[model samples]
Target: MQGYKKETELLTKLLLEILPILKAQYNLEEYQSKDFRTGDIACMKSLLSRLKHLKTSKFFSTASSDEDLKLKLKVDAYEKTAKNDQKVIAILKNKEKGLEQRIRELEKANKEAVALKKSMERKDEKLREVMRYNTVLKAKLEC
Candidate 1:
């Protein structure tokens, strides 16, 4: 979960940078005031479709190849973060399994404690009866 959180954070930061470019493209399409043609809706739609796909992708998908070395470095960071996230998830899952096993063991011990308590109560009752019988026998002997 923590890994997922970190991945989400990093993706958010990347999106923050990409959003303005996407917005510029959207406005350009809406106004059609640039080199882009009229039937650019297909292109825009394709871009949006890609965006949707990238939303789920862990490798940080993008619509353009205009990425420079710096952006590529960020992409690489995203890649490393994703790999670390997988490792964290694996570790957490193992820890969860261990915790579940420990809980089961504790539950078994608790059940055993309850059974022991019940047996001890029964033994206490029998002990009281024996003491009472011994007391009466002693009185009779004194008489």
Candidate 2:
């Protein structure tokens, strides 16, 4: 009886760890389409099969109300995790938009500075002509 209890205890712990982790990994973009790796799928399937077997056996009843209570708590936790995931995704999207706008503003400022530099270069040509004219007049007066 102790051996059976220990086996189920270990399996229950394994089940507790597997379900949420598999659910999270399965939803990732890399696994969204036909891109899901065979190995990951196989592992998930194995875990699910074991979980099903554990839940159905007489051994499951050994823990009685404890298992049922734990399951309810785990489900509640998962529900809250879903909401948190959505909030995180929304915040990330907002951050990305802000970063993109900042990049556009920086690019615009760079273009305007370049244009101002070209305008100054054009004015510098005329200024050189005026300086030359003044120097010639000064030399003529001295002579």
Candidate 3:
């Protein structure tokens, strides 16, 4: 995009320098003096068409011959690529942050589950001790 603007400005500058010569060569001075009639419209249209052709020719010729234009185009492409790379890096950083948060959450849940298992095992041991004492009491009562 930047390259295009530079090229446009250069073409416009070049055309401004060349327009007078072309106008004189084409004898448009006489047409300019004509009154604003139907003839003026037709004459202006012809001049406009000629100007378009000149602009196209000059633009293509300059684009082919200008080293500065080619260099600007390359620089613009490099800047665009750099910008895209930065964007991709930013997105990857965001994903990395999300994955790290998920890993932390999973670690917390695992710790809680381990603590609960330990508590359940202690309860089960106490229940087994109570059952053994009840059997001893029943045996003495029967004797």
Candidate 4:
């Protein structure tokens, strides 16, 4: 009986030491109630079983595998593609700016052409009036 009690005490001590570490590593929440006793063998056994399961599962392994490396390579490739796309967008924006400036220049030239055409039309009308007046005066002199 004494030996069994000693074993129980030792188990409790071990559990106290390991529990904090496991909780920190796995981001685990406290499973026991606030009023729960600290040295319950059942609780310690349950925790030990959980730890064993975690060790046997892939969740505990930190070593990078081939799959992880492949994923990293894919991420790098995608980043490169994103950079190239951004460059293309920047180039297109510059072209758009150039086109806008060209449009403005063409519009200004069109306005100037229209103004010149109107001025020429007015001058032609004045010339026709002068020719008609000259013809009338020549006709009066002949008479």
| Candidate achieving the largest lDDT | 4
**Every model's TM-score:** 0.52, 0.49, 0.50, 0.52
Highest-scoring model, TM-score: 4
Q: What is the lDDT, from 0 to 100, of the residue 70 in candidate 2?
A: 56
lDDT of 1 at 15: 45
Q: After superposition, how far is residue 69 of candidate 1 from its true place, in Å?
A: 1.7
RMSD of each: 15.0, 11.4, 15.7, 14.6
Tens digits of per-residue lDDT for model 3, 45-72:
5665775575476433455444544454
Report, for every candidate in turn, its global Cα lDDT versus the true structure.
0.62, 0.62, 0.62, 0.67
In candidate 4 the C-alpha lDDT for residue 37 amounts to 47
Candidate 3 pairs with clashing backbones: none
Candidate 2 per-residue lDDT over residues 1-143, each given as its tens digit: 89965665564554445445434634322222221222244444565565456567553444456556356546656776889999999999999999999999999999999999999998998899888999999999999
Q: lDDT score, residue 143, model 3?
A: 100
| Candidate 1 clashes between residue pairs 3 or more apart in a chain or in different chains | none
lDDT of 2 at 86: 95
Report how far off residue 61 is in candidate 2 (Å).
Answer: 18
Full candidate order by TM-score, most accurate first: 4, 1, 3, 2
In candidate 4, what are the lDDT values of residues 6-62, reduced to their tens digit?
887766655554444445455556545321245566766677677667656564454
